[model samples]
Target chain A: MSDGYTESTIEVAGLPIQVLRGGEGPSVLVIHHETGNPGWLEFHNALSGSRDTILPTLPGWDGTERGDWMRSVRDIAAVCSLLLDELGVADVTLVGLGFGGYVAAEMATANQSRLSELVLVNAVGLQPEDGEIRDQFLEAHADYVKSCFADPANFTDLYGEEVSTEQLIAWDANREMTARTAWKPFLYSQTLPHLLRNVTVKTKVIRGTQDTVVPAAVAHQYVSLLGDAQLIELVGGHNLESDAPEALAEAIVA
Target chain B: MHLMYFTEQPMSAYDEHAAEEGVTALLFSNSNFDPVAGSQLYNDRLTEYKLAEEVGVDGIMLNEHHNAPFCMQAKCNIWASVLAGATERVKIVLLGNPLPLADNPIRLAEELAMIDMISGGRLVSGFVRGGGTEQLATGVNPAYNRERFEEAHDLIVEAWTRPGPFRWEGRHYQHRVVNPWALPMQQPHPRIWIPGVLSRETVIWAAKHRYPYIALNTTIEATKRIWQTYDDAANEVGYDPGPENRGYLLRVHVADTTEKAMQNASQFMWMQGEFTGLAHPVWSNPAGYASPRNREALVEVMNGRRPPPRAQSFDNQIENMQIIAGTPDECIRKLRTILEETRPGILALWGNDGRVTHEDSMRCIELLGTEVMPALRDIGAELDLDGPFDSEPPVSISYDEAAKARVASAAAASGD
Candidate 1:
């Protein structure tokens, strides 16, 4: 709560989007995961120390109205690009956590003129060569949340001992939006790997060593596909932003 | 009243323990499915339907589910088509085709029309949004489920009623050549019956369209509330709804004696966690599949604040009259209470499911068709209940008219 970030609603493409801005320097736009934006987190606080952290709640998340017109992840990507244009932020470092990473990669592929660097943390968007991207929809919400963290204790710490009805509803809304974009082809794009060939921006593909959601092969594939990308394995779970915030922040700022 | 026979046609030959170990229905691996057992079960179900027709039930109801061991009918229309050819006198009521799953509604319209023609216009076409898990299995987005369902329903209705060569364009579905050569034999298309458990939106939708809303084994209290909602919606659209606009599906198994009937009725609980718990919670109530209000109610169920209808103990269900199993006379007496309270013009008797043997099912169907159905008809006549066949349902209003009526009603309620 003491992240020094100010939250406001910004109009982009005629849709009201919730944006949280803090710190003072080159801008770093943080796209949230499928769980929606978990408010301004520890990583945002740490990143705000050096970079101007700009976190916008994706459409259909807790803070923003659902954009029924946005049918696919590409549509979301295009919107984020438009957001950057509206913000008029130059040399933006886009940090995407989990599903947000997929959006970041998509944004880069579409237009990278505004983006200086791209960081994808346990992001799911590519078909794995082996194993599979764990289906969050198939499992219980609590079980899926537990699996997202290395130690279930972190989920307890972040979400308290019991998840509130409001939090559950928000998560359901976020999952609905995720299902809208990522239901078919199942959180991965067949042509994304090929599309990454055109993403020439400097990219860091980070994965938690203990992530059970997105397979390790998928993270490696992201690194392999991106022209100027390197893989960074962190000691955490799928939600590195929450599990190892300081480390994830350092990896992005490195 | 129109009496119809129904069953989930459960394939109960699989290892029950394995099903319990995994998710029971959806996502329950098909590796446990034995084709030989499935083949026999399918034929047995067909045989039961034929017997149901022979025994004198007015109609035979069929439904389908995907990737579910609980139901073997992957496509109910296939069975509807088969029955259209095989049966002579029964209305092949589909409770119904999962409209949202069909990428091609025109093709579906053609199939339904063909079945209607083959059956001498005995097809009572119905539509459903399908279960949330079905959306996952079919790779359909649950967010677009309602949209797809409405669009598909409109397209199919248009295909049946309108002349071909019409250009169709909608949000979720589109066709340049909106023409199906095979139109329904029934004038203005076959009667549409909407079946659901507890979705208020579906009830309202059915009411707005003047389709009979069939409550699928809901509690008596819930069914009353459903009728109230339907009646209120009907009033908004400037029509007085009746029993003809309402139907109720109840799990009623009848036999010569109470003991055998009770034992056979218990088979409805043969599936692990019963019918309600057959699906994994997440799969069953996927995000966006339910409205926000309904989703909150489901959360209450998950939190154990409210028990799901099927989660009640078998005896409790019987006590509640949600399930009725007894001798012919006993069933008729109990059903009279249900009929008196719910007052559905169309009654679907869910005869058998789970491990209830085919022989017992046949006998159950026979008992229902003979003693129970005759008594029910008498009771229905005494109660002045008439099905769509007897009395015409109120005409459906256009969406725009319904919307305007809703606003007017809201304003009137607010004393505007």
Candidate 2:
């Protein structure tokens, strides 16, 4: 009884990108956090009722092809532009979660014409001074993982009886994806805040107040600095979009 | 050789009730979530396993997959450890350890052997080269997967059987001072169940050693060919392979009436369609066989192209017989037909895939156990069938007193 989405590995300019899509409405191009998995059905199900959400797993994440052309965040931004053009979705809301928020900011700054609105949740595109993005998910500790959820009871149904090797591999894959995208000496770009000046889209920086990865102060700065942006904090952590879909839905709809 | 499909945690009361039926086996594939969260999920799974054991299920199963948020348990070894600590009677089947992908098979061998010992002797071990997407994530060369599997098997078996301190050498694997403790409680090794379509290597190995081969859910035409291949290979080798050597997997659901069953199964069918809808054409195409040997028999499969098989009606009961959905009588008839024709010693059913509710699945299991199994038992008795299978493959690990001590110390230190 849930909304569902389907995806395909279309060779866009000879590179295999896993594109997720569901519903039939004005297309909303979705970008994933650095630690994204192949199951976009959850997000697609959440957003499919109103508009088709096209979630494309970033290159080098989830076994997608990392074509030579994709060198930096700008390249990803360029690819998002091409993807929007290919799907023929115009004046769309560019939704990004975590690292995806960085991509949304990039698109808003460089390719603002295609984006009608931008939504960033627990985003990481710039450095922080007071606190740091905890590497719990990447580190794969049982305790840190428990803290990520709003309801710990959901862990068993979502994770299974005990952490099987399959679960470990699944988590490892997520870490691997993060490693591929953000494993350099400094995870986020120090120069990204400067890039935020050019983005003039109607932006909403939705964040989890307790999210270790992207804290509130950083989000506040992005909201204050952007030409037209607002910040709304919620009750979950980095993966709060899926955890608190009601709040997220309102943010997107607003 | 009992076959079981360990289900996800029962979402409804009906599924909980169904877990109590004449179900001899249960499988629970852990979802991909964090381990701390998994401990909570594990309780739900453990409840099912403990209930199934209490209801006299012959075996319980676990499997592994990575990074799927929908499922949480990713590591079967860790899962096995937890299950070993909790349950006592039901046989534990890992179904596979994906030998080729594991960076350390020695650790896997030591761990599996320990699990086997800890669970008294009820461990049905299965080895596999794993699937494609997994290979991609593990960075394993799909082309050399078979070779890697073979090599790992040799090393694990060597670690199990050969008495202590020996040098192990192989192309894909190399280990020094090869010593593994905690041999399996089952004489020789616990039973080995090989699951897949008819691969030449698997069939030959299973036949040569008389291990059970569980054919995964495949078309009737394909099953027939696979059976014939096993039969032909056994005959050529001048061996009379027993019925236990043959088993087929089927997705079945039987309700009060054929109409009810169909109605319940429709959502499951839609789930399957929605799940696989985005895959490349090859994955969704039911009619086509991936290998060359079975190309000619491809046309016999009902859903070759336009009409997706999972979404289609139950066609020619004999031709495309794997999808068994109907009233109890209808299901019993299909089960009887398969048992008679294939003469398989085992019939493993998975009536829940793609949104199949717990109620429907439990109903199917209950009907099969209450009505269908008794009928099959009568038929088997009439045929003068032998009792349940007892032949087990040889164990690979054996432990001396010192080695046992080492294992005990290791297990204690690791808090296993």
Candidate 3:
């Protein structure tokens, strides 16, 4: 819901991906959660207050039709890399949340040299040794929405008035793609921590203080995995972008 | 019109009412299982198959499911071996072995070969892409379900017909030494029968491969549409597909009276509910199991476009002919209508499920054998519908035939 934010479609690996691009300063690449982008929400508004935001609707969500041939997180990382090269965006801030966070971590693993900074919000790339990732796929949509926020929002509010059939289709497409990519080894890759050993990007692992979808220990896990990573425990839960966007945006730029 | 006796061999001894109390069957909770009873149930199922053979069913179909008491027949091929040993005349139709879930296709080939040998070349090998529920159960990447199914099937067939001691490096599977000591009887391999739901890709794949496409337990209209998809695909390749290439699995519970049959139908309802998500949507539709398009259709079904399977009354299923019930005569009439509609040569009769009593299952089996089956055969003759056995389904490769070619190539290479 912000002005000066423009949207366009970009082709990467033969599939068209819808991307939101705008801002006046440094470039920031945003990969959305399993539920797809929250549109140009308040988080985007604040995060891009003085910087550019390059948010692509991940394949199999919203306006982006998944290239079924590309079904792995590693494939997604490749697409993001192509997205960067296509936009001539190097040394950009990479912010990913939940499923997107997994993709960001993967990208950093492959080539963090392209990234100026890496921010993961309630990231799901690492399975915690002490606890397991909550089974979001098994939860009721209403309950899932509830678990995503500390002060839970009504399902109606999250979905807006009377969810459209198209909206439901988009949500399912996103979930299926998430399942295809994340179901094995579950929400985290078994080899990611070992892969992250080589990642030296200025990485930040941000967790909502009460995030239930991802355990608090996982934030620490992410920090431990990266060579130079910081942990930022923030207010709200899994979906801090929607729960407390202004604060999340501040933390991203901070 | 060939009647194939089928059962999930369900361990349905638990309080199905426990579903309301939060017990799940998909990737089933072991707590609900009574091992003592399971032992008996397993024996009873074996006997049921024996009875099916004695009663003159053309074939017997065993399906596989995991973590679900829904189908205790987890390894259909293992049961196929037992059935092969037990039955004399009947074909051991493994309706299937979930190909995508198997980590070793060569092992599967060996096992099927053993069954084919044990049964004296009566194995009808069926391959499945596996259900979405298997995504979580097998922990196989759901994204690679289709790929794994296709690759695994190819690998198994290659292991059977292709002179192995070779190597296979494919996308989803890699075998350094693609060889197996045990090779299938009946030359190349047994005829392949592929079971599918409403997925168009599966229908097309089955058509392209000339495998008999058995439409699983869906409505008449859905089954017709699925058959149409296969027929269209075949027609595109200038092939006129016959009933022999089409199969249908119908959950049929019959008794002496309609009341007894309706009561028994509750078992299927319990399964339908859990599967359709009336008890829980997640049981059947755990995310990523299906394509994005299929998943959306499931969401719409829950949103009231169609009642969740759990909520459907037995009466509704009967009305839709999704489940064929009632007396032998009534069942005969309903089945005839389905036969006319779908025209599947391979008719898989799902005779038992859920909390349906074993006694009722046996009686139903008896009635199906003595009464229902013979009547159906007459109709089959009248309709001129022939299954795989009636008209031998073609196979592309022959191990002995191919072996001769391999020997020739080896001699030529030696420059002798």
What TM-score, computed on C-alpha atoms, does each candidate reach? 0.94, 0.49, 0.87
Quote model 1's TM-score. Answer: 0.94
CAPRI grade, predicted model 3: acceptable
Most accurate candidate by TM-score: 1
Candidate 2 iRMSD, 1 decimal: 16.9
> Against the true two-chain complex, what DockQ does each candidate achieve?
0.61, 0.02, 0.44
Give interface RMSD for all predictions.
Answer: 1.9, 16.9, 2.7
Inter-residue clash pairs, candidate 1:
none
Model 1: what is its DockQ? 0.61
Please identify which of the two predictions, 1 or 2, would achieve the higher DockQ against the true structure: 1
lDDT of 2 by residue, A121-227 (tens): 88777776557766432232334455565666655545655644443433434444444344432356766788788778898888886676665677887887799
> Can you tell me which runs of candidate 2 are displaced by over 4 Å?
A1-254, B1-5, B8-44, B67-73, B198-201, B235-238, B256-260, B267-319, B358-371, B384-416
Task: Using TM-score as the measure, name the better of candidate 2 and candidate 3.
Answer: 3
What tens digits encode model 2's per-residue C-alpha lDDT throughout B62-145? 656543322244677776777787888666776567787876778888888898888776677777766433554454544346
Q: For model 2 chain A, give the 10-residue run with minimal summed lDDT.
A: A135-144
Worst 10-residue lDDT window, candidate 3 chain A: A152-161
